[model samples]
Target: MSLDTSLLPNNIFSLKNDEFFQIIKSLVGEGLCEILKIQSINSAENLIATDDIFDVFKYDSEELIDIKNKHFFKLQNGQYLVKTGIKNSLLYILKLLKVKKEEQESLLNNNNHEEQLDTKFIINHPLLRSLVSYYKYTDHIKNNNDDKRSFLKIFIDNIANNLSQSNNHFRYHDSVKQFAAVLYILGGKNPGEQKTGKKTS
Candidate 1:
């Protein structure tokens, strides 16, 4: 069936401007991605216990409730029917990455072509989210190893072209300034003086 964008779940929307992204923020890295992938395979059941998911993962009620209001329907028995349509296409990509057995820069950048952010998908894409979750689960044995950090460094390096300050990926200082500006305004300092941190007597 062809996807009508209007009918698809909020999970597939751009994270930069989507409120659903913020609501589900608590679930990321806590196995919400894993549960979604598992549910994607069994299109028949379509139901899961959020409470039981904490058996292997962890979450508080508020975190669960936040996503529940948006991405799940509460059944009479309390199981959640996932509202997201995680199709076979996602499963195929997960399987393909499994076959690779290691991170590949080929998935990162096309050196033959110019890099452009507007022309490409954001880092929060469901597709990339699934692949990252797949690699993380597969590499569970090395979770605490120093090599894992090295692996991340290598992964970042592989896509470093897109992570530059010019691309809005690695402008750590700008973010710091923005954060400081918020604090300065909250402190009731003069806007011009906030930049220089000077006091006028």
Candidate 2:
């Protein structure tokens, strides 16, 4: 008997900006990306939980070959976009990460498991809120280690700079602000800043 792969579950994808932002914020808020393990990506059962939530990325049947090649998987047109195999793998990884973070948080009461934050400073700043949300929600979905590290550096720099510029109350003076000192490091171009303009040489 031949196995029918089409009978399997498909995890969905969404491309809407609002939905994208919502997913991004939720992942950052959950804090799973900071501690998720690579091995969890292989968990099969985790793949099933995302079946309904993953179908947001639909495809054009006219471009079936190109879509399959670009997405690195195959799927039938009109099938809920989430149930395809490659998407299933991605969802499995995300679901496993989400569950793992929840487990970690539950173990933290009266324990030193949670990372310490300076409480005297303003915690309700908009950027800070965004950062915390991003940190928590992206915990499960950010799978690239290098990308995560880049994100962490950018996140820290952005938060520190915002706090410093908002008011003089928070102090990090005398300490070198290599990344935060210049706007260029964070990829912003100042009015008088020179632009070399992407020359490979």
Q: Taking the tens digit of each residue's C-alpha lDDT, what string does model 1 give over 1-201?
A: 333223223332233222332323232332344444432322211222132332321333654565565555667976766544422333433333333322234444554243555235535487666556656775785664565565554554445544554655643444345656788789988656735678655
Tens-digit per-residue lDDT, 95-200, candidate 2: 5445544454576652553333433232647666676666666666674366556656566765677665757654443323444557555575543445765534
Q: Candidate 2: where is the Cα deviation over 4 Å?
A: 1-54, 59-66, 70-84, 110-201
Clashes counted in candidate 1 amount to 0
Question: Each candidate's TM vs. the true structure?
Answer: 0.22, 0.22
* Backbone clashes, each candidate: 0, 28
